[model samples]
Target: MAWEIGAVRWKVALALAAVLVAGCHGAAAPHAPASASEWHGNGAMGAADWSKQLDVTITIRDYGYLPRELRLRAGQPYRLTLVNYGSVPHYFVAPEFLASVATRKVEVREQAEIKAPVFTSFELRPRGGSLDVYLVPLRPGTYRAYCHVKDHLAMGVEGRIVVE
Candidate 1:
């Protein structure tokens, strides 16, 4: 009877050790890509060929978007690069602005390239992370762009995009 008990204990100890060893080398799950949207563009020009696009860089700091206003023309392809200089995560949210534009793609530095029909907003992880958003304004209008993280908007992390 004592031998049987000892054998069971040894088996249980071996099983536990095996589980621990497996866990130590377990691989983390891969990151899933962002979902694509069905809405393309609203009568906007189709995707621009890479060579002809213009580039604009926007720096994001603690509480503001540098060059608070951007003037862009309708039907012209522009690449807006976002560089975060803040200590916390920040999001660029512009619903109306995004709606009025046709997205080509969004590229996160060393991360992923999100194609057209991109998400309306994107988050930049704290400090120095960058995102490149390629798009073309489809309509003539003044749209608001702001960071939707906590009270960042109220703190003045806002801007305007004027499409002429």
Candidate 2:
């Protein structure tokens, strides 16, 4: 009789614990402020490739970049038109482009390491301006682009491109 009571008690406790854990997992968390790399994807994350030569128009405002999301087909070649609407100079960096400002005059892609800048760069400033960059969408993965300016990216100034 004593053993039976102990087992029943343990079962009930386990069932309650399971229910609580399930509820916690299912509950949605509160919304948080946008992050620099806070790209939720373009309206076509899973949609078919609409066109090439992306002809993207990106606007920089308030130390931030607008239309912060991009979707693309992997390995496809395209061109991006970058516009700087901010009051300061910023760079669109492809992390694969490594540099040592302390010595090197220019940043080069790390080819031996299997990394390259899909979109190298386009120096931008305030008001309506444009820059063209050639990109070869390599690999099917989501890539992040952000301002390499001091504390600019930290201020939620970033963009994302999806290579699907």
Candidate 3:
């Protein structure tokens, strides 16, 4: 009877050891991608094909964005043009939305063509300043877009970006 109890305890110990080993191995392997290529591999564009992409413009006003709510499609490439008509400099801040999309480049009219994996914000120059963002939307969700310069959000300078 004592040997039977010992045998049961040994079995339980082995099972617990097996579970611990499995958990340890799982922790060593990452659940998320380690690099940008791995993260954007599903929807990244390999070549520049602007002809097929749709153009979407978001004009910046004094205390709001035109159209109020911007809509986009997942897996579609877009030329997102940000134009500031306001007298003061305004920032287009959409951290989560920008992170979800795979950015190809950002063009600032003879300033520079920035190639990056993601963009969190852009400060549009005051009065007729513009920039173009070339990107492919990979995730489908609603993200908040706002202007972060001096009580702008409080003054209703906020909108939503809905990707479907």
Candidate 4:
């Protein structure tokens, strides 16, 4: 009788532990702020309704961006989420590409939002960090996006953006 009681208690404890572990795994990860007020210069040209902008995530690894070619509409607003998964810092540089767009804001996780004279390139730190860039392309063209870090571009860390 005592053995049977002990077995039941053990089963209950195991079940409770499983439940706690599952709950922790199901928790959501932190995300960028969704409100216009949370972004810098809320009055910026492309700082329109966040709910209406198309969101895209680009992953940067050791040698390249996941999707080397990106397609965008000329006048549509877009929210670009850049995630760096490599062990070294990388830059998203595309001078001509940025010149063809009306930028809204650039947001780094847990940092201040950047607005105004938009930058032609942005740096991302190594490993598991992200930045959000908002903009609207104003013309149709194919532009090159490359990393300006030492020898990164030569190693094939480059991409293309086609605006139509």
Residues 87-153, candidate 4: write the lDDT tens digits.
Answer: 9998888878876676777888688798744467778888987898888777699999889888998
lDDT of each: 0.77, 0.54, 0.83, 0.78
Model 3, residue 42: distance off in Å is 2.8
Winner on TM-score between 2 and 4 is 4
Model 1 lDDT-worst window of ten: 29-38
Clashing pairs in 3: none
Per-prediction TM-score to the true structure, in the order listed: 0.69, 0.50, 0.74, 0.68
Against the true structure, what is every candidate's RMSD?
10.2, 14.2, 9.9, 14.5
Cα lDDT over the full model 1: 0.77
Q: On residues 1-164, what C-alpha lDDT tens digit does candidate 2 reach at each position?
A: 99999999999999999999999767522321132121112222223243644555667765577778877665444555567777777777755421100010122223122122122455666665555444444456666778877898889788777668
Model 2 whole-model lDDT (C-alpha atoms): 0.54
Model 1 spans with C-alpha error above 4 angstroms = 1-49, 116-118
- Clash tally, candidates in order: 0, 1, 0, 0
